[model samples]
Target chain A: MGAEVKQTILNRLIGGIDAMSPRLRLAAKYIVDNQSAFGIDPIRTSADKAGVSANTFVRLADRLGFDGFDDLREPFRVSLLERYDGSAGEAWLDDLSHAGAFAADHARTLRNEMDIVKQSLRLLTPHKAEAAAALLTEARNAYVTATRSSYALAYYFHYVARMSLPHVHLIPRHMGSPVDEMVSVEPSDVLMAITFPPYSADTIDALRLARRSGMKVILLSDSELIAPAIQADLFLKVSVQSHHSFSCYAGAMAVLDSLLHHIVTRGGKAAELRISRYQSLREDFGAYWRAKLPRLRRE
Target chain B: MGAEVKQTILNRLIGGIDAMSPRLRLAAKYIVDNQSAFGIDPIRTSADKAGVSANTFVRLADRLGFDGFDDLREPFRVSLLERYDGSAGEAWLDDLSHAGAFAADHARTLRNEMDIVKQSLRLLTPHKAEAAAALLTEARNAYVTATRSSYALAYYFHYVARMSLPHVHLIPRHMGSPVDEMVSVEPSDVLMAITFPPYSADTIDALRLARRSGMKVILLSDSELIAPAIQADLFLKVSVQSHHSFSCYAGAMAVLDSLLHHIVTRGGKAAELRISRYQSLREDFGAYWRAKLPRLRRE
Candidate 1:
């Protein structure tokens, strides 16, 4: 009764929504979108949140041929509880009817990405990754170099690792050259560089400078042959397979994330501990908003 | 003889490098880092790139007891050719004796990320993803919002899609509230949001605003139940599994990349066409460098 009756009433409201006046239509939209909210919040609260008068909902209820607002709300209240209690979601998960041709292509895109991640992970090779992580960890300073398309991966890696490892830094900081950042680097420092073909000449230059400075080089790249140029001490291969003829960053993304995870693990300092300070500041500064108003009651 | 003599020469130079004068050590460092360059470039060119006089090479050759600089270069030149022709690189790649326990753990990190990508891709459901991409592609404007950890994913997605789709924008533009960026949005717009556990309240606020504005909502989250609150027209689940208890972003990275690929595919626009203009500007602005100094000639 909970599923059937509420769905029927929902269909009736949805079925006749466009024919209704704008006011009733808005009310119907609110009810449909906020069924769980409506089941919990007082109708006045719901009406206020919906930006419509309480009489609008009553009118929508009248239009739907419900006796009144409470008559309209009762079924949804029972349905919301039933939704909370049900295993029916499993059925929805099992339904995989391919809607169209585009869907089939979309599916292939995901499969390709998964395959790339798997293949790339195999290339990372645990021993090499540990040695790579060790170079960064043992260094007096670890300068990360990447540009253009690979910048996001470097940022993600640097942002996470920089939290616990104070010595790690992203080079070419804020539109400056890697030379500017590497200027003060000691011979014992490490350079972790990310690049893929058509590799940026700037990245190669940075790798060269790191070598000249006697810094250990750890490279994440799409090709093994790239190592021939800079002689990267530890090479992490990022497989960038794509039929789209563009850089697919899934491998780089996974490899960098895994490396950062290793950095955090080796540091023995959980990010939560270092991050709580900034988290509290964000809260204090009101950088976050509260969406507590429209929530369904747990009880 | 080329490989063996080159190896002995390299080992001797590396072993006795520290005992040399600062100028001589710099030359050795240059030779070590640019092995192929030393093998291919004119000695004068190598000397200039190494920032040393040609006398430095001749004197270094005298120190190594070679007949001259070219005599020293001959072995490296032959060795470089051998490197290009040999199948020996496979042995180096296969030399994965785990240095310690950390290597084993690092391997697991990669394996875990690969699994997360696989698990999350299955959750995307091809038809649902195609519909999601269509919603974004067809929308008047697609507003992407995420805070904290998920911002990087939104940035990567928005950065890629906004190149081709001018209507796609990241909300809370440069420290503004999502409401401020979303204020001008019409009912035909779409709100794309990313969040994981302990989700940001502001993301939910933006979703609410999008709903109130009668815009379609598409959410990428760690849970499907998230759609129940916002009534997201489409939901793409991101799996954030990690043993260390911090958010793992591989799935989000892969899914968002795949979704953007779908959007580009549906739009029939490759990113390169639009990106070429900025790429040209970068070249004009001298934002790149030349690593052309170091090279192994193709011949």
Candidate 2:
């Protein structure tokens, strides 16, 4: 029943997109694009994401024949509830219990993961990556921000980038106040924000703060239709879809890896020297284990 | 030249495997199985990994007609040196420079990741996953630890497990001292250690300390030939190979996901209730974004 209502809402939004005002058009487009997220997220959150005011959301809902915003959101909530009501858990167990079931499931997962990576690659063009890299290269400082599951990508990017460039930082360091961390982000800085569905409020807030501060914002997300993408100077979409409840991150990791490689390679000899120096320092610090065996027999 | 020498060593080990005594056979088996890693790691590390004393490593070298362990390790070191001389970097750049290169590279990475996941699935059978899940279900406390690149897997595992189980802990919390964190891990507790090649010394040290405290260790790694694997009550191998410099972690993540799903489903209603409680609490805390729009038009 809820799924039917969602389908109707989706059909109405898609059909009505042309007749809406510019702001309503943007809201309609976002709703059309992120129907899944729209179903679950709050109006204020979705409004903030779509780069429109909450008033705009209410007007759009009225235009769509809904009694109120809550009515519009009900279908999404109902669908999510149905999804979380244990069917996935049962299917997960059934897949694991039988012979060849595990193998078949694994094969399907691999295929889904591959499809995600392909989609991400198609979305994240090299031209856009190069442009983003140029911004990072030219910026006085570079800051990376991501929350929850997406934080790993931010951390990995910061860790590897800082090895070759000295000005890279991971925001909200040591669980400090994010506002405090963003205070120093100047207009000359580049702020890279990564967030996907169940989009993090903290990350969205950070991106807003960065934009207000005049920093060049590079947004890596699952889609350009997302609200954070609206504020981005450069928006790179990377798919994170998966067969399981949690999203797969391989595509994100690969995209970041490629971006870093471009940055380093473009930086030329200076980057190479810095990386070598870092490697040598790591060796000097005894950071890696030595493989020496005993010499008793030789003696 | 280095490749030839490494190949000769591999052939010799294979030819001599059946003729050796049981202990020597074990050493030979490890040496042959981990030929790639053997070429890079120190002999003592390899010997320790094979569950033999350093003296056995020296004796094996003697039996192989090497002057000492150093001589036996020379080919592997030389091969590693040749590899590190920079062909991979050149190939990486070339792949990124052309049109459709990004798409092609992504496809290859997806294929490689799929292979890794398949290999890991093959290694980690249903029976083995059930045994590990049973241990996790029965444990009084479950602590998860992984560092550097592999840390994401540990974080994801801990995050999801904690949603359904109260006793789950992330080791070395907030990047604090691992030793201090493990001080209270009792015999009834379970320690899950995840590490991969160019493995972190800190994780290995933590695993050793946990073993000394009589905690059961579940080790997740790229290969069973690693030193920590020897001490693992449960050693699960998940490949992390990639065309790029850094390893792909999707395989490890998939394996951990499957393991956790098994645990949750096997734990039945208790796990479901806990998860629901977590979801409800998240909603209550306003941890998620709400979609409420302003009442401007309605008023």
Candidate 3:
């Protein structure tokens, strides 16, 4: 679900808890009201503060699909962490139940992320994916431009795609007439533009110009409501969740990685031979990387 | 093994094959003598021209540790495709038996890339990664400056890192005296410079100026040989394999991805909180990527 939808669900749940059994509803209210203290305070301490029985809290969790109160505390702890720095995490541990609750919530979030990934894959038409692959494979020249958080996504894709194609260029930032350059983009070439919420004006301008030149365009964005659809040959709408305060990309990165794998797989025999030749050159350079071995340091 | 080791092994294998039985040796000689042309002609056609039996050609593949003749032909096909584009593949289909050999060779290249990634991970000291992370994380302002191909790499890193840590800037190309700006850089701020082989003289000049100001410096490069290490508080060297005539980023992207993962993991609660707040605002403003997803087709 998009961020707006998810937040709306939470808001409704909070509003409707009064319709439940008296004790269960009371526990739910306490949980919601004291969420900011979840990780910092033990459930027993929270129970004491909320004036609710521990069993009632556990029962409320069960009603919410959690095994016990610990599950309910997870989201609360995450919220606390999202609101404060790590230093505040210690303050949250005033009781041990907070950690267990937080872990359970995190586990659930990961499961939701997996579901999103599957849904995303399903929503992507096979023809669109194949078209993207063809564009990447056939481009004599590929230009990738992105700004803000999405720029890394474009840069990573550009770097990998450049290996098998010719004349791949990464457009420079603030360079004169990025759009003018796009106006000359060849018919067979592709311009990949990646942007998320609060899209950079420059990236949008470039995509508009590239499309006007009759070049193919691909977009990776957060919502269909605000995305640039006119220039997009293929558009992928992704909903990202934050672990703390910024939008998450674990899902986006996974999808991008799969796309790269698919491109290489379909490149046929020519790609294989080029890779073989590269292996020879790598050995020739001694490639200073040999000095470091596994289990040495974390990069 | 790097490109050098791969080349050495190839040479050794070819030499050993040349010294074997007369028929085997002749087959090897024909292949070695016409390495470049193998992709241009089918195996049967080439074998007939060499006066060697088709079965003898199959044995040559087996002697080279290939499953069959098709396996052996794959490499040639790949080479031609990468070097000559798709036109060459059209001319090279006569050798149906060489496919199997080439696929295995290609798989080996990915394995080499994995090795490079492993080595890069090991070489990147946790101390440096943390120091670099902390420098950028704590900076009141950060500037990313790079030229040529390295420029995209620098911008990508800056874009992602800037999400949680705001106040980061991407210097517009040729904006003049990036050094002058760095001269005013305080101890709490940082300047990141990226340059790879055939390193740009201008990039070096800027790094030297930045270093003199006692501002934190981070350097990303492909080879330490070409990248000066003196001015950097942290240095990361990544190796990229060449495919066709272009350098591949299997290693560089992997290292960069890993860095982002590590930094976010270490950022703990602060990152999550920042992300949450950012997401909230992102939904409200949608500034990151609004224009890339065009809604209507343009003529």
lDDT by residue for model 3 (B129-241), tens: 55666666677777787754456566666666666567676654444645645656666667777665445655666677667766787776664323223436777765543
Which candidate achieves the best DockQ against the true structure? 1
Q: Could you give the candidate ranking by DockQ, starting with the highest?
A: 1, 3, 2
Each candidate's chain B TM-score?
0.61, 0.61, 0.55
Q: Where does model 2 exceed 4 Å of error?
A: A1-111, A243-245, A276-289, A292-299, B1-128, B242-245, B267-299
Reference-based lDDT, residue B277, model 3 = 68
What fraction of the true interface does each of the listed models get right, in terms of native contacts kept?
Answer: 0.28, 0.05, 0.11
Higher-ranked by DockQ: 1 or 3:
1
DockQ of 2: 0.03
- Pairs of colliding residues, candidate 2: A42-B290, A42-B291, A43-B291, A43-B292, A49-A227, A291-B42, A291-B43, B39-B76
DockQ of candidate 3 (2 decimals): 0.05
lDDT of 2 by residue, A183-229 (tens): 76789999998886556667777877887899998999876544423
Error of 2 at A28 (Å): 62
Q: In terms of lDDT, which candidate is strongest?
A: 1
**Total backbone clashes of model 3?**
59
What are the DockQ scores of the candidates, in order?
A: 0.11, 0.03, 0.05
Chain A: TM-score in each candidate?
0.64, 0.61, 0.55
- Write the number of the candidate with greater DockQ, choosing between 1 and 2: 1
Q: Give the TM-score of candidate 2.
A: 0.59
Name the regions of candidate 3 deviating beyond 4 angstroms: A1-147, A152-191, A195-299, B1-115, B138-143, B167-174, B186-189, B227-231, B257-271, B285-299
